[model samples]
Target: MIRFIITRLLNGVVLLFAVATIAFFLLYWGAGDIARQILGASASQETVDLKAEQLGLNEPVFSRYGEWLSNAIHGDLGASWFTNQPVTEAITSRMGVTLSIVIGTVILTAIVATILGVSAARYGGWRDRTLQVVSILGLAIPGFLIAIFLVRIFAIELGWLNATGYIDFTDSFTGWLKSVTLPIIALSIGAMAAVAQQVRGAVKDAMRQDWVRTLRSRGISENRVVYKHVLRNASGPALAILALQFVGLLGGAVIVEKVFAIPGIGQISVTATTQGDLPIVMGIVVFTAALVVVINLSIDLLLGFVNPKVRLS
Candidate 1:
């Protein structure tokens, strides 16, 4: 297991390097004259040129990439051009908000999906049909639309919660949770639906396996046969899908954050892009890429533990 973990960690490092390289070149290539964008339209040509030179934009892409990569390795993600704050500091400051929402939604999704999926699979008929309809509705609705509707009903009409902005958890845990509740629900809807479908499918497949048939034939209770035998076997695939979804939830939270006005990495990224803050944008991209790599590696390691055959392979 240690050997496998080390191997995966090394692979994650390589993957992150590749991602950083691609992000560097792509941002430089796509964002032409980043200095001008940063300096603004009214700035003189000479001033813009000087600013570009200051930012090292005049250097070859490969050279700049090497410098950025080297600094990043040392935990220096550079300073934001607009805020003049360390990129890491800025991201870390807002990490709590994003982490809270992501963790809450993921937990909620897992519980809701598991219960609904198992129930539907066990009682396959009207209950299954009802769950299918609900899942379909979840998939069809857009998160932003849900956020809007939630804001209207809960924040505007009923006045139960604050509709805009974020409150610090340390300041008021209740307020923080209340404020983010709608956004979390909105973000979780699609994930819950997808996970439910995956779990239902996996459970159904597991129930048809020969082991399940034998267990049933041996006069094992139906609940034990389904939950203990079938669901346990079915959990591997469901867990894999859930892990992937957890990573995806990070990306999806960005849009939900924007709709609900939560100050997080996603909101910061969006703001930096609109303001043409190249440093912050690159920092965000690198950070997000690193997160994805880490999540993937963790999932791979988890799979090994969940299925020893995978470890042997």
Candidate 2:
């Protein structure tokens, strides 16, 4: 298990390094005259030259990469060129909002999907048909549209939640819940539908196994046989599917944040990219990569716990 963990960590570190390297090169080479962009087209060549020189844009790309990478290793992701704010500070400040929505979505999706899926599989008539129709519609609709509908109905019509903006959980836990609830629901609908189908299929397969009959023959309660034995056996696949949904939720949250006016990592990322704030953008890239790595490792650990055979790989 230790060896498996070490391997995953190393892979994650390597992936981060690769992502950072690629982003740095692409941003520099592809983005034309970033210093000029910051100063605007009206700025004189001499001023641009001076600004570039100040930013070490005068240096070779490889040389700049070396220095940046070295500083990054030492936890010095340079300050934003425009605002002089540290990149890490900028990302960390907004990270919580994004995380709150994403985490809530994950939890909601998993629990509800599990119940719907198990019921659909075990009872199979209207429940199965309903699951199929809902999953299809959920997948067919875009998340942002769903978010818009939620805001319109719940926030505006029902007056249940604020239409826009975020509240810190520290200020009021209830306020925070209200702020994130619609966004979480919007992001989770599709994920829950997808995961529910996966769980349904897996559970159905598990039920077909001969051991299910053996368990019932041994006088085990049907609920225990299904919940304890069948669900546990089927869970490996369902967990894997759930883990994959994190990536989708992270991405979907970005669009949802914009619609809901929530301050989050996605907002900063879009801002930095448009403004050519390389330091903050690069910081986001590395930080986001690291987050993805951590989530993947956690899922791997969970998978190993659920199905010990995973660790053997």
Task: Indicate which candidate wins on lDDT.
Answer: 2
What are the per-model numbers of colliding residue pairs? 0, 0
lDDT for predicted candidate 2 compared with the true structure:
0.91
* Candidate 2: tens digits of C-alpha lDDT, residues 41-112: 999999999999999998889999999999999999999988899988988999998999999999999999
- What TM-score does candidate 2 get on C-alpha atoms? 0.96
lDDT of each structure? 0.84, 0.91
Displacement of residue 52 (Cα, Å) in model 1 is 1.1
Q: Assess every candidate by TM-score.
A: 0.93, 0.96
Best by TM-score: 2
Model 2 regions lying over 4 Å from their true place: 308-313
Q: What is the lDDT of residue 75 in candidate 2?
A: 99
Estimate the lDDT of model 1. Answer: 0.84
Question: What does candidate 2 score in Cα RMSD to the true structure?
Answer: 1.5
lDDT measured at residue 302 in model 1 versus the true structure, 0 to 100: 67
